[model samples]
Target: MAKSTTQNIRQIITKRFNGFFVIMLGAFGLLLFFLFKVVFVDGPTLKADASSKYLKERSIEAVRGNIYASDGSLLATSLPKYRLGMDFSVFKTSKMRDVFQKNMRPLAEHLSAFYKDRTADEYYYKLKSGFEQRKPYVLINMRLLDFQERKTVLTFPVFKLHPKNPIKTGVVFDKVNVRYAPFGQTAYRTVGYMKDKVRVGLEGAFDKELAGVPGHGIFEKMDKNMWRPLDGNKEILPQRGLDLHTTLDVDIQDIVELALMKSLDAYKGNYATAIVMETATGEIKAISNLMKNEKSPTGYSEFVNYAIEVSENDPGSVFKLPAMMAMLEESHMPLTATVTTGGKYTVYNKTMTDSHDYGTLTAQGVIEHSSNIGTIKLMQRVFGSKPSKWYDYLRNFHMLDPLDFQIKPVTGKPNFNVPAKWDALTYMWTSVGYSSNTSPLHLLSFYNAIANNGYWVQPIIVKNATKGNEVVIDYTQTQKRDSKPICSKETLDKIRIMLKGVVESGTGNNLKGTPYGIAGKTGTAQRRVNGNYIKGTYYVSFIGYFPVNNPKYTMLVAMDKPLGSSEGTYARQVTAPVFKDISDHIYARDMKIQRKLSGYLPDSLNNASLHHLIHPLDHSILYANLGFPRIEEDGRWLSFQLNKKEVKNYGLSFAPKKVANVVGMNLRDALFVLENQGLKVRAQGLGFVQSQSIPAGFPIQKNALITIQLH
Candidate 1:
């Protein structure tokens, strides 16, 4: 038994020894496999210089797209700019050390001299740090050097001899495209800014189409510890980004920007916004917003794009337009119907008051005068205590919902409380365009509908968008065109007339005699914060359409919290003037509506005031009507419309009487009536008769038609 045990122990020892040897061999083989992956077979790849190293990466950059305006003007564009770099490893030469050092010193010196403030020592240290860090290529400057500076740097001392003569080094430079906006501060808000090397607005919204595809290349590690492109290697070309064309008219944008700036300057406010749109096409001609830095109110300013900025309380009087329209549609109220305003009304414990006591005025006059109490009374008479119809109208008009524009923002959304205790107070305020929120764009669009003859075109800023010279996106006109008329043509016409009257002789009369007739409303809403009204916070706005007779453009100007002003009626004195100034300039210059009127003339000229001419055939003249027969809408007497039968057989040989209600008559008939009425017939050079000395409905008792003339 002992002998057998000894034999087993010896065999076990021999077996163990052999197993240990085999295990050691297997471990060695595994180590060799890892070593092969690192050093020989598919080794860890560190890019190097081609023509020297066995492998390297050659990089090719992609090109970004250009942004163009509606008229093909350059708003933003991308230009090829090079990022200069240096490979100091190439300067690590031992032979001819003096020559290499000499060449490099001058190159660094030249760079420092040209860049000013950047010395040779600083650049050298930065390059050395890059080398020590084992960086593949060191960036000396990024987005550096405009076109001229870059050209100058390329021709600098020994730098020009680089990658060629003096040092025979491997300091490679690369070029890439970078976006640039020429009109830096203008319309920056609407155009937006870039983040994380990516653009927004027209640049970012269309980034995928605007950003080009990246390319790939091979680089080899060379002998001088540098990377160089491989010669004649296969290349994958990058796709160029598509150019984008937008419907933003540059000229109109300038006008809008200027107007907003002027309004903000005059009002001394926190911010202001304005937008203009073509009444017929729903095309946004221009949009501008100014945001004042609250910290530095007077010195620092920015564009806030207040049109879409929704953080404002709903306007009070301006909202009355739609409220009255809804009431007219539902109740068919006559324009001449009378409403009594005791100056205030109480509903559900809440009291609403008018700006002033406009007691027992016609409905049309209430609108022209912008009576808050009048509108509430109208709503109560029509909707009664039922709040459902008011809300239904709001929904039908899409006023209750938030707008979805290109930017993701919290600016303009209406807020209404809904918790079962819905009352008449809410409906009353809603009738006057308050108790909810609205964007300037929203109000402008509503007025645009009235001006568009009841066709509600959805207001859009981006009229047409193109990708790489191809149209990729465009908005359709408002879907409300096919729907039922929100207001009857007759009601709309009456409202238009009233709106014009407002500018002519009502609350908005400050804008009268403007180059184009303005038809819209004014608004001043007290801002509420945290369930309480802010005493000093008010939103003042003027929403109107130009050329009211045949609507062309509708614009809205809003001033948010205009500081240092006691009267909130600043909307007319401040906002309305902006619309007037811009409309006059745009209509005359771009639209070619009428010849430019002499800037030196006054609206009301006396007989002593010589005839101011706007065109060749017309002259400004004043006359008194001798008798009342008939008149036309264009301020011309309709003497031709009257005949011998109408005149009767008067032996006194009475001349044809010029009608004193000479409103809306053509120039030809007006001249005839003025001549026949024993009054001097003079024509103001061609345009619609926008103003007159005598108000309509007033007889020419004493030379009342004396100031009648075409605009």
Candidate 2:
């Protein structure tokens, strides 16, 4: 019975074991079927799910536009920047291995030269490791590169991309917009700034045109909350902002800032401002406002747009210009009319005085000498009965009218007392730039009108706004025309003469002896502080235009009570020099003003050669302007010859360090060339350079002195 039970138990155990094996095989078969399904059917869908997810749409910022000066110099710009990277994906194919290997040394060498951050050997090792390991992505340079720089690097050896070639350099660059101001702190305030959504200057004025519109795009959310741009690119590309071409001449602006800073530094002035306007168009070429501050790194900073500030001090003698104009317009009074001006005159128990007493003076003399008493005397003579006649002329001249400047800086209209609130002494005081005030810019515009043949138009800072070649805002079109000038030509002629006399013989006598003519006024006004005029502290200013005969530009320079300056010489000491300096620069730059006086000589070859001086001047235009008969003269140095006896010298260009052929050059022109080549000059005699100690075409030597004998 035990044997029979054992046999049955064994048979049952074997059958159960076979059954368990069959069950295991079925489970394995089921697993294999699901694995086959996943590998073929579900693969694409699962991978797509892993690669993407719907997230909130993102706003892509448009490229901000560039702000350029009048000369096409970049002031503010937002450019796309890039970072260099490499991919060794090409290494996956053995067919391109030789081509890639051959480029390794040259590519490494080029990288070393371009970056200058690593040696050729170091770069070679890095390149080899990246290539051998077949790095999918390797950052070659983390440094941000400008558009031009990345473009240049693309042409280098292995990095170069070919239009026809199937293979790529395995190089890549990431891009982002970077805003830059090439000229730092030069026109810092005027070029503008934006902080906390509060903008200032041009930035604030044209934010819509400069900041650009933003674009919306749907992007895939990746690991670490990063965004991945979707293919089929559901992105709405942003439109680039319009480019602004401002009226500012950065070259002139730099000079103005330097000139003003120099004067302010020397005088220890608290604050100073200067503005240059195109005489005809009222376009501001340059404007600078600097305030004294110890906290600043440069001991000065620009914050307040004081050039256009409304609440400023009295303009002193400068205001006498409009006062005189009013007198001329109202009664048809001649500027030559005699007005007796004593040492002192008491009007309504208030005393008005002059620096020095003149027994009797013409109406023109009042403005020329900047005579406070004479001006008041003219006002008393002309408008004594109804001083409101003087008041009425203010409206006619647009004195109280606040300007709609392109810079958008004015807070209020001019600070002038109304006629209804006038006292007895108001007319007497107002006759000589007292009790009324305006911005330096307003004052500049007023002076600019006189320079612009009495045409009063608003000043604008932006020339135009452009998108590519198309104009978005033609500011020139916005300028309106007037049927009449500020005054009659006869009055303007007299005003011009009076202004010339000021520099030639009157209060502005110190500003005499300039090569070019200057027609303007010198004003020294008492600074009204806490409702009282400060004795030592005064606002000294100079407002004028250069080449008085034909004005091209007008400028105003004002200083708020320079520390070491006294009342009498404040304007002369501080502002006149700046005016003269800028005037000289402007005059020298004008091709129309290039005239040279030659010494008389016999019509011989020796002297005739003297007329053929080499200097960079277009003589064809010069001679044409002079109405000289065009003579047939051959050579690169274009010379204008009246005859063999009277010939004018000029030239084109000179290479550096090469001894210039200045045989026919004047002593001034000869010295100019030699000294510029780092050569010391010893010039002799009068007139043009006849002969030189050293021959032309020789290499220059350091501290070398070149002597020239002039005939």
For lDDT, the strongest prediction is 2
**Per-residue lDDT for 446-501 in model 1, tens only?**
78888887877665555444555576655453223425555678778777877987
How would you encode candidate 2's per-residue C-alpha lDDT over 607-684 as one tens digit per residue?
443345433333454555645444444535554444444654443456656888788765445654675465666655
Off by over 4 Å in 2: 1-54, 81-176, 219-233, 292-300, 410-412, 565-569, 596-711
Off by over 4 Å in 1: 1-62, 88-99, 124-136, 162-171, 197-200, 212-235, 293-303, 406-408, 411-413, 417-421, 467-469, 472-485, 595-711
The models' CA-based lDDT, in order, is 0.64, 0.77
TM-score of each: 0.71, 0.66
Model 1, C-alpha of 353: deviation from truth (Å): 1.6
